[model samples]
Target chain A: MILWNIWLTQDYFEKQNTILTYSAVISKAYQKEEVISYEKWSECQNYYTNPENLDFLYSIPVTLAILALREFSDDISRRTET
Target chain B: MSIETIAKAIGSILQDTYSRNYGLSKGFNLMEKEIALSSYHLLMRYADNDEDKNEIIATMIHMLSAPFSDHEIDKITQYVREIFFKQYPDEAKRVWLALIKYSNYKKANPSFYRYQDEDSLNKAEENEEKFVQQISSDKNLTLDLSEISLEKSEAYLLARAFVITPYDTDDKDFSNFLNHILPIVIGDLTKVEDYSYNRTRESRKFHHESISDIEQYLANLFLEANFENSKSIFTTLVNSLSGNAQRQRFGRDDLFEFVSTTLDYFVLKLYDNGNLKIDP
Candidate 1:
């Protein structure tokens, strides 16, 4: 049940913040002009293995996602008022 | 009764309830059936134990006012057990494997806006089509390759090079042009180590080892090619660069920029003006 709830939350977060989450994953694994090596790929995957690691990876994207969603809501509300 | 017995009974009841609520009057609706299966799977995943699953099933049977016969309970338990323990786990593993394949493919083809969600991906594709149409369809669109990035210029040149008309890929000189001279012209051979698993790595090494006077060799190869439409432009390019190569004025980046821009302009003219007019 605990695992299921965690998976559901993760899935929900993914649907809501597709760009943010994916960009975070890509940025964590790659940099411009540098090859994405197997070592970098493993490092990104390892972050999802534990709660502490997952928290570290999610922090930035989650913050940005909330800001983006809030901005979208504001834009919609403004358009509706007009 | 065994755990399987209760699960089977519950699974049947769940299926019947789904059919009553979501099934079309004429036949089974595939979309609704999919939703039902996914909902049932989610419920099973959440239950986390046989007892929890069986209790849910028993409660549902009681609420629905359905006859909870012993045989019926046994059959539902069996079906639920098979799905939870066997089928769903296999599906999850299949999904995991596909994700790995997709991740690796993305690493190989690195692009800024290419890796996106479905809507954005479609938008990106549409934008690409618009760009191609704008460039390919317009006859008077004069593109100054200098103003644009090296990537776009390279793409234009390569796109023209790959065309079958006038330039035959099966020809030895054309093959030489692509395999040997093009890398020197493009100036990316030095950064071949930074390419993650590209097919051109071995060919790059071969080109580097075999070619000594790369600039002169590239110019000679271009002149040697019997270009049906752009021979005069190719000759002019060779003539213009020969002095610079002799004086050693052009560096790798300078050579790449000049060659790529010149070729980009040639191809753009081919599409824009519908004629490869010789520049005086």
Candidate 2:
């Protein structure tokens, strides 16, 4: 059930606008360290993809900025209440 | 012997030699002789073994003898022998072997002594002094864009961002945050996403763009999202690129003021709209 919810969340985030979406966050991670090799980026993506790293996810400045947006904040509030 | 002992012996020998025979007691010549003697003494004392010590001693003697007449050379050699030979018999043998071997080598390869001579050394010293004066005066001391290209500027921006992060922030979490945010900041300001298709091939490209107003652009992005510490972060980002501007000595502060002016207006705007949240 938890895995299903996580997958649903990931899918939902992926479907949003690319500029402030999960893809943007991941692209930012890959682009942050210009010297990071493709393999290193893939490894980091896998690491963050895990549900256990949610705190790691929430810690990002961009994540916080995105969450501050009314769309994301309202969506999160609605999800949490349900 | 310890370095101090060796240094003292060398100093005394040079002083006595200068007084008795060399007559190098005034002006640039005297200063050059003193510097050379000190440098040779340092090399001889720290040499790996007897062979290296002999080579260094030979080089020193050959270079020092270049301006001296045969009569003066004989007098200085006799003076050196009386003080140094008696105190160090083994060192005397090494010195003798070095003089014989390297004097022949010096004669055979005269071109090799070009920089080892006084004129070249004096010229080098003059250049170094000029460089020091240039930096101290901060005149024509601005770093060129060629020296720090766009890629390097981006790297410095990221490094500066990491440096200005709060000291108390958790390292892993902050690192993760930086890794996730810096790219977005860089990309938004510097590049735009574009896709191209050629029959069966489709490719994505990031088209580069130059920002005319970094502060204004950042303000729009940060103020729209209501970023915490946006002013401070934007200031650092602007400051990081200040070196790219010519005459950076005063230009940096001017650029910083511009960033402050541009960002502070947004801060005021957000406050007026009752959107500013002071999260304690």
Candidate 3:
């Protein structure tokens, strides 16, 4: 039960954070470039803001990270406890 | 219970639960055993082309493998239609009209069911093609390799080169250093989404002592050299130097050589001139 709870919490955090991080990283990278004018930035931002694109980008990392973290944490805990 | 009954029961339970979850429906199971036998009987009663039979079977299998719910599948279908129809209206319209006619045919005759009758098969192929085209055409989607700042680009490139090299260090310090630096440099280059400073803080724990040792050495060297504002000089030196790339490149012999050469040059400039003194 303790293991399950940890798994759940970590899964939630990873999914929420990865999406936040991905968007933040993309925005920051765009900001770094001088050639991407504010108007162009807004246009690109609007494009990515579409629900399908946002969900697609967000879901990939969330699902991958959750699977990886769950397996890794389970293995570690099993070793330590046994 | 008998073995056949027991096996059937287990299979039924699995089918009810994870079979759908894992994209294995009854049709899929049947199709897997004998490719397009069911579909060919229903869809191509008048047609007898071996290649078409194989193609339809392949498309059916591909659709069955996709992980999507009924609702999500509908959304995907619509999204594909919009993208393809907008971009290549002529071809897209032909495919769209064919799909509509196909859908009507399937709806009108329940007995005419086949693997090829599924709209999802064609929709998946269309979606895959559109995705490839979008990735190829969109310039913004392409990674910007030349945009990296010159001062930091070499360090970033060197860190990448360091990752491919083997390490001999048993000390946790070296492992910790590589773990810390590699991500930051790669993250910067790849426009990776996370740049939280917390990862850096965690990595610093491994080399905290070594960094302090270096800082103390520099402080003493500056003091003995009678450099004015020795404290400020030490602070400036520490501030001006970044450990992110250094730690990433830590275990490489080439990196070790670079650091040694750079340090030797600095020492020669300061101490060989009799400007600095080191107490034994």
> Per-residue alpha-carbon lDDT of model 2 for B147-193, expressed as tens digits?
22222233222222222222122333333433444443443332222
Give me the runs in candidate 3 sitting further than 4 Å from their true place: A1-20, A23-82, B1-19, B22-74, B77-81, B104-280
lDDT-based ranking: 2, 1, 3
Per-residue lDDT of candidate 1, residues A43-62 (tens digit): 43343334443332233322
Top-lDDT candidate index? 2
Q: What's the residue-level lDDT of B13 in candidate 3?
A: 29
lDDT at position B249, candidate 1 = 40
lDDT of 3: 0.34
DockQ measured for candidate 1:
0.01
lDDT per residue, candidate 3, A6-54, as tens digits? Answer: 9999987876675566555443443343233334333434444454444
Q: Give the CAPRI class of candidate 1.
A: incorrect
The candidates' DockQ values read: 0.01, 0.01, 0.01
- TM-score of the first chain of model 2: 0.29
* Candidates, ranked, TM-score: 1, 2, 3
Candidate 2 DockQ category?
Answer: incorrect
Select the stronger candidate by DockQ from 2 and 3.
3
TM-score head-to-head 1 vs 2, winner: 1
